[model samples]
Target chain A: MKPTNILFTCAGRRNYLINYFKEALNNEGLIIATDMSANAPALADADIAITVPSIYDENYISTIKDICLQHKVTAVISLNDLELPLLAKHKSNFNNIGVKVLISNEDVIDIAFDKWKFYQFLMKEKLTTPKTFIHIDEAIAETENNTLSYPLILKPRWGSSSIGIETVDTKEELILVHKLLLIKLKKTILYKASEKEINTAILIQEKIKGSEYGLDILNDFNGNYYGTFAREKLAMRSGETDKAISVITPEILAIGEKISLLLRHSGNLDCDIFIAENKIYILEFNPRFGGGYPFSHEAGINTAAIYIAWLKNEKIKASFNNYKSNITFAKCDRLLKIKSNS
Target chain B: MKPTNILFTCAGRRNYLINYFKEALNNEGLIIATDMSANAPALADADIAITVPSIYDENYISTIKDICLQHKVTAVISLNDLELPLLAKHKSNFNNIGVKVLISNEDVIDIAFDKWKFYQFLMKEKLTTPKTFIHIDEAIAETENNTLSYPLILKPRWGSSSIGIETVDTKEELILVHKLLLIKLKKTILYKASEKEINTAILIQEKIKGSEYGLDILNDFNGNYYGTFAREKLAMRSGETDKAISVITPEILAIGEKISLLLRHSGNLDCDIFIAENKIYILEFNPRFGGGYPFSHEAGINTAAIYIAWLKNEKIKASFNNYKSNITFAKCDRLLKIKSNS
Candidate 1:
């Protein structure tokens, strides 16, 4: 088989895409690596490496474009969100240079990147999701009118890893938090302003209260839902699950199928859901693989392989039924320490 | 009156926000300007001007951050989506430096950015929306199985201004379109690959077939639906209405209110709806100010002022009831060529 020339941009050290490519293609591939950090683990294994600034930098796109042209790169895949838009911006340029960028257009990426808009879309579709609020005034009014129960959660609409999240127990606290949030938003925008500018600030949201679950799914370009894995969170930090167990509950699986039907989502995704009061509410959707996605693969869901096959336009047999029952998985971060005796 | 320092970032020569701010604040604000293009139209009137690359570029943030620190800028208001995230990212940094960013957190931005995810979130809440898809596969399967009818349209899940859209007349066309789409996605992803990476690509969506309309809304951080303007599309390019007439049909207005209640969106938003065969299908949501928004504002809806007031934590009188009938408004973009002979 002829080898495919793939350029993995923003492929961090912990990316599962690397291993999946290696295993599926039998190491018959070339890689061009670009990253902000010189010590990024993926660089050592790449065919070529270039150290660049953060993807958010102004020169990042031009730099990538030049490098792709210089090395005759074939495909570019982003392992993170910040790089996704860059890839998108230069997709046509890459095309002109005979390279492929596996991302949607700039406008699409803009929509995919914002959480509040995503919620609005979901709510508009009548999908099952936890109750959420995007406006601080609306949330405060709800609080004052006792529209929501006490012990509610507050979160920023676009934050990740649990930043700016708080649990409030009273209307006074909600009001105080709103004031603080407005001040913070104002301050941040002002800090980025020029000598004579004003500050534009942040949006506040009412958080959902419940146990969270995740669904990992892969779909083909034709928008067919090929594979899905429902995993229950055994332990979580902020909004991420540190310890999760794969559960093949038919109920959850059916729900996953329903979501797949609804969004027709292609590529890899992690669907977050909340089970509160014995009802399921989808919290959010992540279009790409999450940090701890390997657990799902270990539980017999080869999402990466399916995605690869789909890209090649090959028919894949959905064989995920083998590990469909009460599969348990766990993830932990460990810092290696040398023994004193040594 | 205190001169509230405001920073306005614009792309190219556009300074629409300057006029909006001037009109809203009654010329009581100091407007600092930054644009990548040195000849930007707004630069001439700006109190202070700085040239920077696109807001998505890292240099833009760095430049803005430095400027904010030096000037003690009061507020940062972005006129585009590209700058919104950068303002949001350094929000905390601005707080530490004593400035303000009038935007939401990155998470909120993420959800707000992606239409497919937003639709799913809304669906979960049991809100009313047109049936939509995120994948082409599901759309094709449904069509083949005789689930969907003719006159269906295909759209990009995260698209704007109606790019890459097609209307289907039959199943054969749908299949042909689906195949073409598959090839397009693969080609796009493959072209960017090096020698060993796999390609992943875009999502496909179902088209809402019917009479389409747009609704502009302004909410506070508290989630209250404060102000709204209902407009009917008179002419459209792609899915975006290039020319529209402001209308206040009770049915449309009531639907907009229901959507506002459901989405709990704040600031400026444009919600698209389809009324076909006497049924309303909430098609998609644009969480930011749209291009044709000025028309609605000119038709007696001060959505811009309402947004500003909400940002300032001031009470706003809802003006949605003012326009109770169809008010005709016209818009067109024209190019002028100067003659050297003159």
Candidate 2:
């Protein structure tokens, strides 16, 4: 069997993914994990854990490349949203070193990472999404014109993982929180990403109250369409799905297929969709693995094994497609011992 | 071995504790967990998962008593701060039915649950703690008098977990946030707790800059001091210790002994301490099993087993005290499959 060492970058707390990949390797190859913080919990579970410079550091990419060359990493996967565009933009650098980066193209990353762009893409593609306004004036004007309503969500345009998210119940609160959020955004890590559109950094989105679903849209290395795994979010905490149950519906499956075919992204595409007013609205989509991927894995869709098989040029196993519906799972905390900084 | 069926009330997400107790029982007893929500992750880990009414409901105490009787529970423990006083106040109700509720006395619960009372207790006991002012006028006056400084923490006077906590850099921000916090506190479940002291429900505290430590002070069922296990917090997330390494210090041990002897808190007393400016300060204490218990457990302290032995009236095992220093652990998320609502 061809060695299938996997390198996970920006691996903050996805210890489950590291172990999954390790199991898939089955002692044939090693699992390498990297993060800016040496103490990131995921690092403790990897066969090899390396601490790299911050993604914004000048030597960050070079540090990653050095690790890749030294370890003979077969494929690199990023578990962070902010690092997705960086890896996608520098995919050729790894390719030149005979290392595969399992990231979508830069165009795909841009369309998925930028919330404003995501809204525009949804509009252009005739996909339903919440009404989003980039400017406070525009949002207030829409509210005045009766196009937008109260209880709007104010968040960073380039947000990840629930930073600086606020719900404004009234116009007064919206106006006040909008200013406060913009100020807070500048002090956050997202400021660097939002610097390009500092004026439109904050997004005022209509709040949709309904059931939320997380979709894992799989595609081949060639970006060919694969089956989708859907989970209805039963509970949410800290902006991530806390509890969810596997779901299979024609409407959700059809939408997932449409997104997969349109995006044609490699590996897994994690999409957040909300159903309200009997319409499916795409809240956002991350091209890489997301916090909700564990739910899909627990439901029997073994994407980690599939990724390894594809890397080894083996036929995809039918066993991986044994995903069943109504399988519920909730995220719980487990303790991991880290190497003491003695 | 007596069937020591354990019932954990308000068991929201302490799956680790549930499993720990289960392991200690060694299949000789059952772990019963209850929560207001049917989908609580901790409940799924327990042998008997139960959905109970909200703690504020009129029948809350009766429901718990009924569960204890139905499960033939030998011991009852609670995993929530707000529920601590409720359980403590009704200790005799459970005791009358021969269920040993593993909770502190009402006086200890009152001191720990009320942050203002906790601060006063620290002051009275000649223990060092952050200077706190419950009134906005007094806080502003203290700043103006040069007795206090900028960058203060404004939080609910009766705060549990990380709810309604804010930090203000300047006097202006402090004044603003204090008002905002008061308004926000009323909107939270804490409103019921803070209702009696609505006028002084917000506390402006000095922000201590230093290394934080979580100390688990173990006391037996009879409220006799057992030992103190301290862990220097390496990181914090959502107001709980994320990473910590066990540490042994004469000073910390002395403080733990003093507090344990004075408070005589039953079960585990989780205390938050800070070392800053070459002085040790007690930040707050929760008189129950805390999030940091797992770190102590992984460090070789078998408090779960100890509790079981105590309940069984067995001779205290010396092996249960085999704790060492310099052990570090970080919390990571694990998936728990929950029974579907269907």
Candidate 3:
């Protein structure tokens, strides 16, 4: 077996994932973690913790490349959503150094990161999605034309998790929240959104009331479709799945297969969908292990183990993807301590 | 079928549960909600939104009693964990008024609400639990003796959610957080805990590291033993289950059976257990529909509907408690907009 040396970029609070991978490596390899903060709890749990510059820093990629070379990293995985595009754009550079960056292609990552483009991608595939407007005036016009309803969802065009999301039931609340988002984004140190792609700070979409589902769609390195595992969201907090149960609904699986074939992502593709009025609607896409992946992992899907097996050119058991249904789980806060050497 | 008028006391954000009961009644019954805030989103979804005094107010129970009598409420349910004891104490008063308050016995509620008592109960039952200490000196000594490890969990003797929870790896951090919790508790509006019961602001418990599971143990009014449905926690936010997958492990289920027999809680009993080193450790218990109930509900355990049926003296199907395994679920934020009748 090729010795596995995995590197996690922007490892914030995902100490659990790092530990899981560490266990998967079975002490055969080391797990290296990098974050901008030396105090990031997850970094302390890694075999090697390196504090690096932030994602937007010009030295970010070079710093990671150097880490990869220094540590002989065989795989590079990023925990932050914003880092995916950059990693995908520089996949070849890492590949030249014999490092495999676990990310989708540039087009896929671009569509996944940009909300407007994601909505268009879904619409182009003739899939149902909430009607989204990139401009405030167009959103207002659509609302006036009775094409949209009250209790609209306004969010940053380029956002992760549920930050900057506001639900406005009236045009007044919409106008106020829209303006507030712009002001907030201008001052938001975390948001790296641009004003050019979006006419303002956020995109307005009709809030579809329905049961939500989180899916982990699998694809082989050759972009071949595997099955999809879905969990109906029972409770959510901070835009993460708080409580959910794995389900084997054929329709949802079919939708996953359709999207997988269309997007052609070569690994774990996290997707959000809503079932409103008995019709499935595609909501959002993140081409990485979402905060909800642990659900699939715990339900016997073993995506992490499967990824490792696939990378090692080992024959994977088909049963790995066939997770059992009705398995429910919840998460709680955990503490990770790192002793300071300085 | 007897017409049902359900009253949810201290209804915060459980619009989904209210709507579930509403659909179960099929518009033949009314849903009334009471809270300290008229702006409570769940209250707006109710047929009648009555603003009630705080739990400590002298007229609180009387106000709820009057609402029960006026609305001819068939059932009284509480969403807040703190309110469980209050409701259980006055269950007979509601009973005299021909209203059923869905709560366990006052003893069960007392043990569930008090962390120190819960630890004692678990110890007396010979069950695994994190070693807990009420005094800081004893906690420190335990660490010194190596009976308890570092990375202790410090929180108010009586707290809910993830609030006031501080995990400290060092003795200094533990002491600091303990003092801070006391100061914070003196300012918290929700906690009506008596100062006489707590010598310190916080109870120190050994932080047991492992996979956590949330179980909804169902029982009859007589507190008879029934099966439990459990979900392993995948992720957590703000102390609530964010993502979960359901599993029917026999050992975990047997632990639920044992606890159910010991506690003898009627109706819904929510418990948290951690599997550390193959030992199941009982963490906490809440004798009400916990935030994780949606996972069980969506997994086809219709505990709400079953509770309603059990109260109505109707025969319940045995299969309601036997939910299937491996179903995964997550929670998402939904807008519950209530138009002001004013």
Top candidate on DockQ is: 2
TM-scores of chain A, one for each prediction? 0.80, 0.97, 0.94
Candidate 1 per-residue C-alpha lDDT over A127-186 given as tens digits, one digit per residue, 9 for 90 to 100: 766556655567667767877566666554442321255555666566565454444344
Worst 10 residues of 1 chain B by lDDT: B333-342
Q: What is the per-candidate TM-score for chain B?
A: 0.78, 0.97, 0.94
Better of 2 and 3 by lDDT: 2
Q: Which consecutive 10 residues in model 3 chain B have the weakest lDDT in total?
A: B332-341
DockQ of 1: 0.01
Segments in model 1 whose C-alpha atoms lie over 4 Å from true places: A13-17, A41-49, A69-73, A104-108, A159-162, A182-207, A317-323, A334-342, B1-342
- lDDT by residue for model 2 (B12-87), tens: 8899999999998899999999999998999989999999999989999999999889989999999898898998
Better of 1 and 3 by TM-score: 3
The residue-level lDDT of candidate 2 at B180 comes to 52
Candidates sorted on DockQ, descending? 2, 3, 1
Task: Grade the docking of candidate 2.
Answer: medium
Worst 10 residues of 1 chain A by lDDT: A333-342
Instruction: Encode model 3's per-residue lDDT on A1-342: one tens digit a residue.
Output: 557899999887676688778877778788999999776667767999999999999999999999999999989988788888889889999999999998889899889888888888888888999999878889889889998888799898885733446677778667766765565455453554564543554889999999999999998766788779899887776677766778888899899999998989978898999998989999999888787887777777877667778778877877566687887665543322234445
* CA lDDT of every candidate: 0.59, 0.88, 0.79
DockQ of each: 0.01, 0.71, 0.03
lDDT of 1 at A173: 60
